[model samples]
Target: MFRAIRLPRRTLLTTAAAGVVISSGLDREKLPIYPTPNPPILLVDSPSSLEQQIGVARRTVVGTYDNAYSKVQDVVSNWIGVEKAVENRIKSLHDPTEPLTPSLLYVGVATLSSTIFTRTRSLPTRFLLPPTFLVLSLNYFLPKTSTNISTYLTSLEETYLPSVAEKHAIGRAHTAMTWERIKDFTQESREKFGEGVRDAVKNVEGWTGLKLGETLRVQKSEAVEVVVGVTKKVEEKVEEAVAKSFVEEKTAVDKPKEVPVKRLV
Candidate 1:
């Protein structure tokens, strides 16, 4: 049993009065007083306000995207225009019908040098031939070849590109038509497949007096079981074969070979 210690009412009142007196006697101005913290303010927007904010954000993003796209398009158009201008300038500078005389002359000199170097067994002449050929070709042949190539390309572009573009357009149209035909065929096939599936379900329902869903569920379960059984048997057979092979290998490795003794004859 627990005993409770009780204080007299007069004594308790005296203690409380003393505490209040002591607290009041202390200077309240010197005591630190902390201010109470305010609760966090949560602003919840209504549906209309939220939708308006979303619309503003969407408009900003779309405006940015359009600006960026337009800038890129401008840059690409400017680049294409500059490229065409440069190409036209180059085509105007070079004549396509210009003679290949310098290039031919360099080639002949190189060939003659090679022939002379091969026929003559003179070491100094052979040594001189290569450098001479190099100088002649570099000074004459390369520039002439480059000019001829540019001229040829310009002529070909002027003559061939339009016809080639027309052919490409025709091919693209044919490809589009072929794709449309393929799409129609696939759609027809899908419809036929759906009809066949519905017909099959009706036939099954009529024959078995059971719902097609139930029949399909039953069949699926049986197929799963059969597949599981076959897989188990195959797994067992494979494990047995592996174990047999491993044992055979281990025995072959462990078995000692007999050493043949040679007679001293």
Candidate 2:
């Protein structure tokens, strides 16, 4: 048999508590050690330098201008294309053609009509003959006439249109100048009118020995009092007249009407 050694109660409790603490610490150390996530990396962009910012702004402005220039170039090219097409079409219509055959035929028809008009005694025949000749002449001359008109118009455009444009420009400038003068005159008139009004007010003040505003206010108050008094008198007179008329009507109603009696003889 082993000999039992007696220990103090406090000593036994201390030993048990130490044993429990040691066991718990060992258990915690055995637990899976999860690594703590590194603080989230904040990737902050560095602020742009002044020169870089200026460069960016310059590029943006240049890009906008370039885009506008390209758009204008496209519009101008399209306009030029349309103008060329129209010019080509007009040139095709004005191209020269053989006119000899048509001219000879027209002359023959005209001569025959003129001879018939002179030889024929019939008035209707003569009348018809002149119209026939006229129609034939027009048919022959219309093309030449159109060509000549076109040439005249072209010459007019080149010579007179510029002068007309210049005259229009001059007229516009004159109009602008006239408008400016009118505006100046109106401004001066307004200033003069203001001054005249001020002088008139001063003159009125000197004559009346009162400020214009105060004088007007006084006159207004006096007029209002007069109007009010007149209105009150009119109202009293109306009431008295109405009351008298009502009393007369009541007296008339109260009086009995006399019955008419005819005496028979």
Candidate with the greatest lDDT versus the true structure: 1
Cα displacement (angstroms), candidate 2, residue 166, comes to 22
| lDDT (Cα, 0-100) at 254 in candidate 1 | 98
Candidate 2 residue lDDT tens string, 111-132: 6768676674677776577767
Off by over 4 Å in 2: 3-42, 95-265
Please state the error at residue 43 of candidate 2 in Å.
Answer: 3.1
Candidate 1: the clashing residue pairs are none
Tens-place lDDT per residue, model 1, 1-265, is 9999999999999999999988887856455588768899999966798899999999999999999999999999999999999898766654555455676577677867775766666887777777677656644656654565656665675577977766766887999999999999999999999889978888988998879867777999999999999999999999999999999999999999989998998
Q: What is the C-alpha lDDT of each candidate?
A: 0.80, 0.79
Candidate 1: misplaced stretches above 4 Å? 1-188, 199-209, 259-265
Clashing pairs in 2: none
- On a 0 to 100 scale, what is the lDDT of residue 174 in model 2? 100
Q: Lowest-lDDT window of 10 residues in candidate 1?
A: 92-101
